[model samples]
Target: MKKYLPLIIAILLLALAYLTGYSKYIGLAWYGKATLIGGAGGIILTLGAYWFDKNRLNITLIALFAITTAVTYYYARIFIDSADFEPTAGFVWYIGYHIGVALFIPTVAYILQKILPQSASIE
Candidate 1:
C-alpha cells in the first residue's frame, strides 16, 4: 500500500479536479478541463510507471513520458489558445512543470530520507 500511495493520490487528484468542479477555476469550458486532465495524466503516468520499473527515475519511463507529454501538448493547443481567460503562464508550461515534478519527486524524497541523520539509526 505504501508503494502505491502515489498512484492513489494521483487518482484522487483527478477526481477532485473534475468531480469537484475545480477545473472551472482555471478557465472556461474545455481549456481548463483539458489542461487539468492532461497534467493529471502526466502525474499518473509517472507514478504509475513504478508498476513496470521499480526505479521511479529511469530512461524508458522518461522517454515514454516525454513522448506522451509532447503529444498531449500538441493536441491541446486549440483549447488552450481558445481559453476565455487570459493565460498568464503558458498552459503547456504549467503542465510540463507538473510532469517534471512527477518525474523527479521520488528521487528527491529518497535523497531527503537518506540525508537525514535519522536514516543511519534506522538502517
Candidate 2:
C-alpha cells in the first residue's frame, strides 16, 4: 500500500486539476502559478515514487505525464476556441511539453535527492 502512495497522490492531483477547470485558465496568471505548483508537485511525487521503488521510476514518470497531458488536453478542447485550436499543432506541442516535463522533473528530483542529506526521507 505504501508503495502506491505516490501514484495515488498523483491521480488525486490530476483529478482535482481536471475537475477544477484548471486548463480553462490557460494564458492567465493563475494558470502559470498552477503550472508551477503542478510541476513542483510532480517532482516531489516522482521522487517519492523513486525512493519507494527504484526500479519503477520510468513507468511512474510516464504515467504521471500521461495523466497530465490527458487532463490538459481534455480541458483545452472544451475551453479553447476551435478556430484557434489546430489539432495537429496542438497535439505536437502537447507531446513536446510532456516530454520536457517528464524528463526535467525527474532529473531535478534525482539531483535534489542526491544533494539533500540521506536523513531527509520523503516517506
Candidate 3:
C-alpha cells in the first residue's frame, strides 16, 4: 500500500480537480466542465489503444488531444463572437480556457511519470 500511496493521491487529486467542480474557482468554470468531458473521451481512446496493443494508435490519440485543443480555441472564438457580452471579455475567457487545457495536460503527464516511474505502461 505504501508503494502506491503517491500514485493514489495523484489520481485522487486529478479526479477531484478535473471531475469535480472545484476547478471552477480557478476562473475556468467552463474549462473545468470541458476537462471532465474531454478526459472522458480521451480515456476511451487510450483504453482502446491498450486493449488492441496499438502503440502508434495510442501516440496518435495523444497527438489528437492537441488538435482537439486547437479546435476548442476556434470554437471558443465562435462562441464568444456570438455572445452579447463584451466581445473582448468573452474572447479573453475563451483563450484562457484553452490555454489552461493545454498547460494542464503536459503537467499531468509529467506528474504521473514522476509518481509512477516504474510503471512502464505509461509509455
Instruction: Please report the candidate that would top lDDT against the real structure.
Output: 2
Tell me the TM-score of each prediction against the true structure.
0.39, 0.38, 0.42
The lDDT of model 3 is 0.52
On TM-score, the leading prediction is 3
Off by over 4 Å in 1: 27-48, 57-61, 68-123
Off by over 4 Å in 3: 1-11, 18-21, 25-28, 31-35, 52-62, 69-111, 119-123
RMSD of each: 8.3, 9.6, 6.2
lDDT of 3 by residue, 1-123 (tens): 433333344445657775566766654358556565544544454345444552334364466667767767776666667655576566656655655554453434434545565444243
What is the C-alpha lDDT profile of model 1 across 1-123, one tens digit per residue?
A: 444444445455545655677745633124554555555555556556565664443554557667757866684765467654346336555655455434433433334333545523122
- Compared with the true structure, model 3 gives a TM-score of 0.42
Candidate 1: which pairs clash? Answer: none
What TM-score would you give candidate 2 relative to the actual structure? Answer: 0.38
**lDDT, candidates in the order shown:** 0.50, 0.53, 0.52
For model 1, the local distance difference test gives: 0.50
Candidate 3: worst 10 consecutive residues by lDDT? 1-10
